[model samples]
Target: MHFDLPDLRLFIHIAESPSLTQGARKAFLSPAAASARIKALESQLGSRLLYRDSRGVELTPAGQRLLQHARLIMRQVDYLKSEFTEYGTDAAGHIRIFANTTAVTEFLPEVLAGFLAERPGVTVDLQERLSRDIVRGVLDGAADLGIIAGPVQAPGLQVLHFSTDRLVLAVPLGHALAQRQSVSFNDTLAYQHIGLHEGSTLLSFLREQVEKLGGNLALRIQVSSFEAICRMIEGGVGIGIIPESAARRHSRTMQLAILQLDEAWAVRERSMLVRELDALPGSVRALIDRLKQGV
Candidate 1:
């Protein structure tokens, strides 16, 4: 069967979006045109590629295989364009990363600052997402790399150790929980708690865990950053659960107490994820290497 790059690209867009109309819009084609092209592609390949429903479309088994190949082909095509373009100037590339709250807020800023300083020709697009979503984005080619926390079961992705993260309760110097060495997260739910802003991955994870325990987090206030959360706790507004790294950094000036969590999930191993480390472009691989070195 014969198909063109546009056909492959259109299919990739459709699979990523799982919405025919949205995919057509991304490809700069009308819905009717996109549907016709998809029909033609199915006829040529002699396979039913998508299962359509009222909500959206889902890829069939053959479609999943085609998607894997399509992503690889597009990545190679992009690499070729970048390589040829660099003949007239310094090497240039872009990498996309999806990471969780701790990696995005506590870790990546310093690491990326140094990485970008040395490579003026390179750029990065970073987004904060839940660990599960981060894995899916990397696997589906939406992101070039991912940083995830806790345990992950990824079948086809390469995992690299990044760092360890611990979630702890931060309280004012004389708070009742502050006198204790450690406590279950459930024990803190009765007290008012400061929290990160809505939609933060940490806040979302905390909510999920609390729900599992058949309780709710009594959030007293919402703030934008971990530093702000520490400040709020220092002022005796409420206690908050924050990454241990942030707690240590802010504790130097803020009379805050860091108490370890008893739950196993509170201690997490952060890891770097990539679909195929060897297949990545040189510039992308270099950044990963730098991150591994703690630079």
Candidate 2:
């Protein structure tokens, strides 16, 4: 019950090599020392663990069973070393995280909260920027990580799919578009839109959609957040297109209707972007893993 790791490791080494002399050499012990150690281990276990002959050493049944458990124990020890190694660093680190409005509003707050909770030693500098700007921030080394909507053009950037979201039109309960289930992006253009600020990703995307469809995106007002846009819709100010996740949250608190859009470009894929994988520090790599897990 109190046997040392060296005994278990030597048992595995001898079992693998089938030669006490060769296994002892591999374990950095003399043959005489290896033989004495095995005898002591066998005496402690109350069972013979090896068959030694001119051919070399072979494991008895007990040695095979010990080998199985020893492998499991070694794996757990390795995991403990890997998992606990990061906690040894006392220096505080900051990760510059840049994300678009949709991800910042709809998804990442919860993810970041959990990541920060588990990693108290690290600080996150979260910034809201457009997807293009997020890419620029990473490329310019201004940000360590980026979460942005795709159809992105970052030739040298490493990216992974983070989440999928769609832009939907939200309207008041008795509004003209409420009775219908879906509407084309162009068809909704006639109605005034309550949107985010002019430079927001959603606003820029809407403007792009309007130009591609040859329609007028009649924007009558602009707000800072999706909740504000939904509140404007609830007050009968005007209907607006917002992320489905943000729309769902506001719908619970306000009398708003979610209308799915009839356009193919409505679904937006969000991705995590980095300059290079190996360039990141171990702690930063762990942060990326946590983000990938949505932790």
Candidate 3:
């Protein structure tokens, strides 16, 4: 059966939100208009796509099948728009990028600025998420690229090494470890530490390193973002170990002192993730090339 792009989009939105009003808001249409469109789509396809109840909307069996294809179709439509718009335009299109907090606050601003300077027409949309979620975004074709610390071991992803960033200890200016040139893993264990919330890759890496040194890192504050952790550090909540790049960004604003970790505990590597090596768009390729060339 033939289906228009708008119908496909509305279907996907309805399936995602499962609320007629919510889907209508997303589609910028009134609830009545959205419902009419959905009913029209169902008529054309000869199936009931959704069932309404007191709780919310639920998808029918056929709706479930159509939802997957609808997402793929929408993604291809987006890719087509980006691809055609970027051609012969010196990067005049949307590039959706996903990154972790560290990359968002520390690394991406400069890279995006340089890219936009060279190609002023390009628009970049950046979303901050955990590293694993960033990878998932790329893999699912929701984001064109990802900037994260690795090692990420997804099967179908093309990983490119961007730069190495060490993990450093950030202490309040007057803290005892502030004067230390390098802190041992065991030394960090002696203090109450500020850590990223559970499921964070950086937190896991730090925990593993400390455990290896037979150090029980006591986590005092569990924050979800790097900025929050920095503020906590600034408030003298506890010392934090964060990416050197991120620590550098906050050093000017907060009365924080950065100390290097012993080489054994130093975490490094900022990797760029893409869906496939051969599938990169020209705009993405240009950005990656710039990163590799350090231009």
Candidate 4:
């Protein structure tokens, strides 16, 4: 089907946004115009693209396929614009990166800062997601690259070693589990917990692990940041599971204890994933290479 760049841009925005109106707003189109453009695109392709419902919009199988290519096409267009317009200028391209919370919170900041400083002509669009979702987004071409942690499987994508961070239980200094050197997740579930909010990947992973073992946590408090959770743990509120990178730094300043988990999953190796290494623009590729420095 012959659709213009605006049509494809609108389609990609609609597919990624929570609602059509929101997508239209992002695309700088009115709702009516967006709807008409979508209809025109679908008619050209001879298939439905999106399924609309009360909750929001979901991509039809065809829509999903279109979205995958749309992202790649947009990236190419962006690259072309950057290269042509800024031939002699410093900044040139955009890099879209999707990373898990662990990577974002613990490691990516320093690495990304270094890359951005070295490559001033490049801009970055970074979003946080769960490890599995990061892998899915990369494979689907929704993002140029992804950094994920935990034992996630990405069948067809290229995965490179990124970094490692241990997950541990943070307990009050005088709490029962505090003095223990290493404890299993199951062994700690019976105690009250201070966890990240429900939608966090870490929280979901912990709950799934507990349920599989026929145990559950009594989450007494939920907080938005690791610092808040650590504070609650130090106040004898409840135990919390947090990345060792964050917990260790806070441990020296707070009356909190870090207990390692006996489970193998506790020590996780993070990976940086890409759909195709060679297809990336030069600036984006440079950033990726810099991120792989220590690996």
Q: On residues 132-208, what C-alpha lDDT tens digit does candidate 4 reach at each position?
A: 77888888777888887777689999888867889999999888887899899888888999988766778888888
lDDT of 3 by residue, 1-295 (tens): 6888988888788787958889888988898999999999889989998998877799999988788678667766766666677344347666788876667766678888889898876778888777778887777666788888757776788889978878888999889888888987677888999998886667877777767777688999898877788899989999998888778888878889999988654766778898775555567777778777751
RMSD of each: 3.5, 19.7, 4.1, 2.6
Q: Give the TM-score of candidate 1.
A: 0.81
| lDDT computed for candidate 1 | 0.87
Clashing pairs in 1: none
Any runs in candidate 2 off by more than 4 Å, and if so which?
Answer: 1-91
Best by lDDT: 1
Clashing pairs in 4: 91-121, 92-121
User: Candidate 1: lDDT of 263?
Assistant: 95
- Predict model 4's lDDT versus the native: 0.83
lDDT string, candidate 1, 17-130, tens digits: 958999999999998999899999999999989998889889999999888788777767766665566532224677889998877888789988877887777788999988
State TM-scores per candidate: 0.81, 0.67, 0.76, 0.89
Best by TM-score: 4
lDDT of 2 by residue, 209-266 (tens): 7888777888779999998898899999999999898889888899999999997788
Q: Which segments of model 4 are wrong by more than 4 Å?
A: 18-21, 51-58, 80-91
